[model samples]
Target: MKTIAILVFTAFLMISCTSKSNKIIAQKDYDKYMEIKDNKSKDFAQNEINFWQAKYDKAPNQTSYLSQLASNYSKLFENTGDVKYLYKVEALLLQVNKEYKYTAVGPIRSLGRNYISQHRFREALVLANKALAIGEGMKETQKLLFDVNMELGNYAEAEKNLKYLTNKTDFDYLIRVSKWNDHLGDLKTAITFMEKAKEIAVINDNKSLKIWTFSNLGDLNGHDGNIQKSYDYYLKTLAIEPNNSYALKGIAWIAFSNEKDTKEATRIIDNISKRHHTPDFYLLKAQIAEYENNQALKSKNLSEYFNMLNTINYGAMYNKYNTLIYADDKNTAAKALEIAKIEIDHRPTPDSYDLLAWSYYNLGDSKKALEIEQKYVVGKSFEPKLNYHLATIYKANNMMAKVAPIKKELLKSTFELGPTLEKKITNL
Candidate 1:
């Protein structure tokens, strides 16, 4: 039982915000929820985020307004694929609970999403339980509870919630079950679940669920090392939502990983670049330039990346490009250093600690990197990327004797690449 994201705009709008002007602003954002659908609109969501952030400053503990604001931040987090703001959102929700007598399911669902983001499946399950206990008659949020349980490796609980998904107003209910089934380690079962959702989305022409299902299938293929199949799935996804910048990035990476066709990869990369300003697009340009052996262009683009990471406070935007989009380990080290400074200074969380560790590891500071990595690895399972870095650092420090067990584990991971993952095995 996967939980559909019910924006709950109307319900949230009712309790939060008293000022007519602020309500008007929230209405403006709600309009876009229905009208806008493109990666280009990522920044537009940011603008709404800014609006809510400003409102938060003016009225700090106003539960209604802050709850509304938290929702917007959650949206930004989803778009950027960064989770730091999740910790921030959790903090805000706690504040909401403190200020208002009641705890709402919206904030709980948002936090569960964050836990899911971090891959802290068990923790997410616990929080989802809290949300379910507090939310009466909110079937969607209850489904979210079931979703987290499924993610937590509890298949039976997810199956129990199937009855609530019957003929949902939105087909996301079906899609959620499919993903939960996928996580349960039964590919055949997962496909059967998704087939029902796909059938409904196709019949109704639900763009959101159509794109969602296709992208998911693409990831499943990629995990199995079926690169061409994954590539074709991604192509199908883009046909549904041509401006889904994330999918565009995915296809470019597939081209790079499978074909290494500079022209084809660069074309996809350029597609992401044409969208609204993102620190990532510039980084992609740098990567394209590097692939072309255009030293001057590469240097220029890298310089922009440096500026964005150092000078600009793109917040999640900086991390989106520097942290998530790029594949070059060494270059990521530089960007990570800049990101660490900002994150640790302006805010701090497990992710910031991990970023600093990766930067230090890349810059040859094994001792510092090891210390920070040790602190971060507790919650690091949510982040397989960090495990790769840790393996690299351990091997470099003559700790292969300690790394062998982890290497064996990595070799069998769902995300493993044959030779690519082999490179991490110490003493192999």
Candidate 2:
């Protein structure tokens, strides 16, 4: 009888552990964050913009008011995810740069950042170089150069720029190092560096830095398979900035991907969409609909996404998403190939090449796809989606040996890829 009791107790303990592991997120933890409707940040940004615009109108010669207006518009873009505000900022910054005769590093660097946000990495790099030639803000320009070079896949140049700003105790240096480590696939080291940066953010008590650190930690933790830690970090982000759409989206991802609670995920996304209205949210909703096998809902969301893209002059910002979407349809595969080539010209990153390869694979040229993957995509990118494409291209080319390892790796990334791709990855 004692032996039977011991066995039952062990079984109960195992079951309890399993249950605890499975339940990573609780609605109560994020319910208040979701209920936050008032966008105080956006209100303040608009107020600042109005004040700056009035000043600029009164003193047309004062370029400083233009800079202030640009800053406010950037804040609005950050808070609302509106591309129009971003474009407004870009125009204002360009005017500021022209007024300064491209000699001022401040507006030059700002324009470089704007170009980076627009995915115009080559343009950003040129701006960074121009800033470097000005020699007014060497360290800042080095940092911008590092960022632009990384985006353009100029790793050696990025490393040189990183070396120029190698202050281990500096918050900016720490975050950049963390990004470098992440790019190198040393996730544990990357998280450690980011955690150090988070500590500095806490010590400085800087709201923007804190929000950036917390939200980035959420992403790194999610990629590391620490979904509970990721959820907690996102909650911390929301605690600081209640209207932070990125943090809310992270929680929505946890609900959808880890918990498979599609209804809760959709609810959170819908709430965010009411205010943010970013096109990517529609894509995410469509993905959720696909997972639920709601074809009509999926089609509606995709149509909305495409309509937004068609209406907005987003430049190259959404090219990758457009390429992937078009690559999946037989009728649009040619367009996907065209955009993929444009994306390659824009950045030439391995991920861009993966899009090109995937487009070729979809267009019924596995040999060309394999050639592109071998030259650019293989061993260059560690993204799960890119690896899935690599595996698909390999399988199509009768390279089962290459496909096997990638398939194994992808199976472990089902949570990150979400429920919709689980069967697809399994079948790979």
Best by lDDT: 2
Q: Where is model 2 more than 4 Å wrong at Cα?
A: 1-21
In candidate 2 the C-alpha lDDT for residue 372 amounts to 98
CA lDDT, every prediction? Answer: 0.55, 0.82
lDDT of 2 by residue, 1-428 (tens): 01101111111001100012286778888888777758888999999998989988999999999999999898888877778988999999999999989999999999988888888889988999999998887988888888888888888899999999857789888888888988888888989999999999899898888988888888788778777888799899999989988788888877777778889888998998888877888888888999999999989999999999899877887888889889999999999999999999999999899999999999999999999999997888777888889999988988899889888888777777777776797887
**Candidate 1 regions with alpha-carbon error over 4 angstroms:** 1-134, 142-196, 203-205, 288-296, 306-313, 320-356, 360-384, 401-428
How much is the lDDT of residue 242 in candidate 1?
A: 54
Query: What TM-score do all the candidates reach, one by one?
Result: 0.54, 0.94
- Model 2, TM vs. native: 0.94
Q: How many residue pairs clash in each candidate at the backbone level?
A: 1, 0
Highest TM-score against the true fold, candidate: 2
Model 1 scores a C-alpha lDDT of: 0.55
